[model samples]
Target: MKKKNKSKWLVPVLGLALLAPTVLPTSASATPAKKVTSVEFVGMPAPATAQDMARVYSGASVKVTYDDGTIKSFPLTYKTLFKSTDVINGTPAGVAVDVHGKPIMDRSVPDKPVPFVSDDPDSNSLMKIDGAKPTGLGGNPLSLITHYEYITSDQSGKSAYGIIPASMSLSTIDQNKATGELSVTDVKKVDFSSVGGLWIPCNGSLTPWNTHLSSEEYDADARAYEADPAQTYVSSFTKNYYQDDKKVGNPYAYGYIPEVTVHADHRATVVKHYSMGRFSHELGRVAPDRRTVFFGDDGSNTMMFLYVADKAEDLSAGTLYAAKWIQTSDENGGTANLKWIKLGHATDNEVKAYIDKGIKFSDIFEAADHDTPGFTKIKTYPSGKLEWLKVKPGMEKAAAFLESRRYGAIMGATAEFNKMEGVAVNSKDKKLYVAMSYVEKSMEKDIKGTDASDDIQVKKIKAGVTYEISLEGHQQDKDNNKINSEFVPSLMKGLIVGEDLPKADEKGNTAVVDKVANPDNLSYSESMRTLFIGEDSGMHANNFVWAYNVDTKKLSRILSLPAGAEATGLQSVDHYNGFSYIMSNLQHPGDEMIIPEPLKTEVEGYINQNFDNKRSGLVGYISGLPSLEIKKWKNTNKPDVTLQVAAKANGAKVTWNNKEHTVTVEKGVNKMVLKVGERFVEINGETFELPSEIRVKKGRTTLPADLLDSFFR
Candidate 1:
């Protein structure tokens, strides 16, 4: 086995942040804001907690009290923007469409997680929120905020959820300017025809430039496509996406990052960042500097990937690096020093050109199942799969980005990480946190430990552990070439580890309760100094969303997902319009798995009673508090959510042009334009940035509430 570098482990200390001040709203309403000291959710009777495995909370609720001891609590709902089953604009609810904007009605998955399948792998795990993008709002309540959300796929085939297409819904949300409470007003699936359609888009993060950066997980094996281009599952995807069985989908296209740009017209355009290496991407999450990105490859035998763009906030071009883990200790979730092997630099179009030229894996590497004379023996992917591979002389760039995992391994980078999931950054601590959902398989020593080929050898944590990568500037790659970005990962060690219960506690519990078990999705609030961890575990009957205060090191259970459901869609916004937001969503619930006996039966009954049709999940936010409150319009005889800015409330005439997808504000001699989906408005065809965009909702034109009082005057 080949080793990338010979660097020993460097011990690193976990630095904790100082406790942040209480987040209290500054609105002078004579009512004092309640600071959240800690939050605890009412856990359902389920496994691990020694509760009934099947029982789930139906009318879930959250109670908030004021500083003066005035108490008020609302039920779990009354705030849900929409369920996966909610149809808007009279369309099919959450229909999964292919590349051509054609619905692939037969794409399905069985309830519960699948161990493994031939081409399709595990589709049932957790639902990731991918973070919510708030448009047209800077900080403070004077500006009403608009939100957009996305949920990606877990590649399921043939079941009740076939229409949901791994299932993605882009819900349009409206935020109460004063309270920071978010509610869904519109929901629709993003069209993907312009960019070869989305392929298994997984989790994502909102870029600092205010765009959505999402992943396409479980990339179809390119080798399989090369052998029988017209007979593989990818071909089927092409048929579904293009609505033509004759169309064979390109394997090179599905694995890269798909960046979504939202326009003022309620439309989105997608572009694939081929510059980012391909694999089972859980995320291509950007660091604070905006130039650096860390990818989570979510499968067994994957490499830890990092990419630094040539320019800040531009992912179209970058130099990629893969980490070679050098173990220093095998105790306490292990410890490692990381050395990066510099992958060749390229732009998006550079690699896409090769892909367009029909570059094959053989074009990049020479591979064999056994030790052929010239082939290098390496175990790079899956749990036990082995390959003898050698990179082609002139195809360096192709090997680096197109067949990245194999190429990284061939170049001697460590490729034994397992179930490497979500990644998040604590800019304050200058640290990066990543989730390894299952610390097993290749992460163990025996997989490829012989030649230091498999450098990570930590005790398996079936319930999982969240690893922290210490970030520092002035670092260099394994070759001692200076790294371009300041956020290079230096030392890595487990920050939050889950413990296992001695045995199953009736409810089929295997992990200790009151602690993190199978930590998955993560988002950090810089102002709050807290890291939110979501779980996708079979060890617990009910998955949970935990808020880990990094400064105080307190693990608080803020919310509990339904029984048999996975906790996902975790994101933290420090402040948007003066109010902070914690974005969250649960994937599929009501599936029977892992739990035993009466618990399963009870859960099945409960699932049938609660889960609407067993296909819908939820997209919502954490409630109760924010830091500021803008006054709401008196709202006399208006809808729960209405376009009630000052102009609309005062009865000003606004016209909507469906053909142009624009809203015209007519005030004699004031011939100007405010466009939707765009944060800018044109005054007499001269464009200028607006604090917020002009949007058309409910067939009516609406300008930012804060703008209404000033723009037209």
Candidate 2:
């Protein structure tokens, strides 16, 4: 006789699990969490000593609130797959390679970290591919991680201000069957020399079709560069990428969206989408519909952009539009009704033809410093530069995607968004979240349509705000054409706001540490009902990764990085082998902060101690989290969301593919498999009659209330 499973159903949507078995070892006391109520993170003390300032630590304790209001705490430690200093083959991870595949050296540092080990590693685009990659533990499910070096800084710590081409690497990461941890078997640099290398590759997102959508931030001012090539900072790109300074670089070739496709053999291929308008692209978050995309442009005087592909799961061709914010209220960070203004439409090949044919910015628009008769007076958001220009007639497609910021202004879209960094969406809630790093300059209270780009005028919050955009279906573009997408941003309001202190606190902090400060990267977990925020702050003494539960409105500071580092590579995956991962990375551990003298010096020493002379960044995840992948299911005389939650809590791995789901749960050495939408299941290799037929609804696998007891028992 066995005990019965009193729980109902379990739904493990396509969530992603993470890291290698050795990312970090769990203690002997560590056990798989059975039931999760609410996850609460433990915080660390503010840094005062050299040891405190440079320490990278995590309490990783989870206090989950249960259904009946019972609370239990457990340990969830932090683990690292690899640091930027880790080497594979003969080169360091994320080093920019040449056309001939040699490491690019930075002439700035004495013991150059450029070729030795990139100092500013950013984005961690982890995704699984088809087939298995051969590993020492045998063939494991193949996974590819498209990670990159944002921009290499010197020993003095000048980031994007310095000369260096951003680089990306493809690492072969797969789970170890024996230990149930991820293993990093190989690392190869994805060469972008064929497309002007990479330009400040900062942040990225994964496409709906399981591809990597990376970005080129800080879009170079091509007009100024073309006018005076010798003065532009991108000269290093030509010298490093092509190994020739005289190779004459084209500024237009570096800013478009680059999509990477991972292979079964652990290799990656990249293709730049010219149709998706580019201007300091932070994250190109695709909607669940797969075609609609919202971009976060990072800089002062930026614009909100949207693109709808001609077909689902395809970004090669699309129609570009910019947002016009019609303010609804001036509360919190302000609420507004968004109006889409049609910029233009084009395909990837159409825009690339102009780049290959040597089309200049002057060819796209004839400009003047003053208002002229035929010129349209428009101000570009990212640069805050006013220009009088009109499309040169034939280069409409080129101007639409290449100089998207300027063209957006010409179409009467709102350009007042400042420091818009990361974008995330929740399909279930029909919501989109965008991070504004600083709520000043463009977003400060101002008169509408003055310079045109400064339209968004809300009370300044400086510390920052995360906006929630409402999504609606059956929308039309500015030109009154059907947008053909279900996810269109209709209204936006601030969901989370950071508090700004009047003066420096006792810890010399300008912003409240208990709340978010300059929130940069955001990843939303639907099942957990949590919004994960990472800081890229100049106001806080130390940066933190926070988990803010949307339901309970509880803010928990989960992990703290070195004093001056900003958090990066934050992504939330729902289904991966019936497990979930909250991916995050640390960058520029020893950056120069604007704090007072003695404290700053103390913090610098701490960074040196923890980071060592390598001054390298790390890539890892917060581990041992409870399996909260279950969703509600309706059947067996009730509607329940805890079906999959119950199954996972009972140590089961549920997977969905082609309307078929298999639940694999183990008790001792006996492996049991339950196939939903079927009458019978298997125990290892032997057939067994189910007490009742398991079912599925709306593509979700559900457990029948009566059948669950027999199976678990």
lDDT by candidate, in order shown:
0.62, 0.71
| Positional deviation of residue 467's Cα in model 1 after best superposition, in angstroms | 0.9
Best by lDDT: 2
Q: Report the lDDT tens digits of candidate 2 across residue range 56-140.
A: 6666566655454544344555677777778876657767667777876656667655563565677777776767456665636
lDDT of 1 by residue, 220-286 (tens): 7777668777444466566655767676567887787887776554455678899998888888778
Worst ten in a row by lDDT for model 1: 11-20
Q: Give candidate 2 regions above 4 Å deviation.
A: 1-50, 65-70, 108-116, 138-146, 155-162, 447-450, 628-713
Candidate 1 residue 413 Cα shift, in angstroms, is 0.9
Error of 1 at 207 (Å): 0.7
Provide backbone clash counts, one per model.
Answer: 15, 21
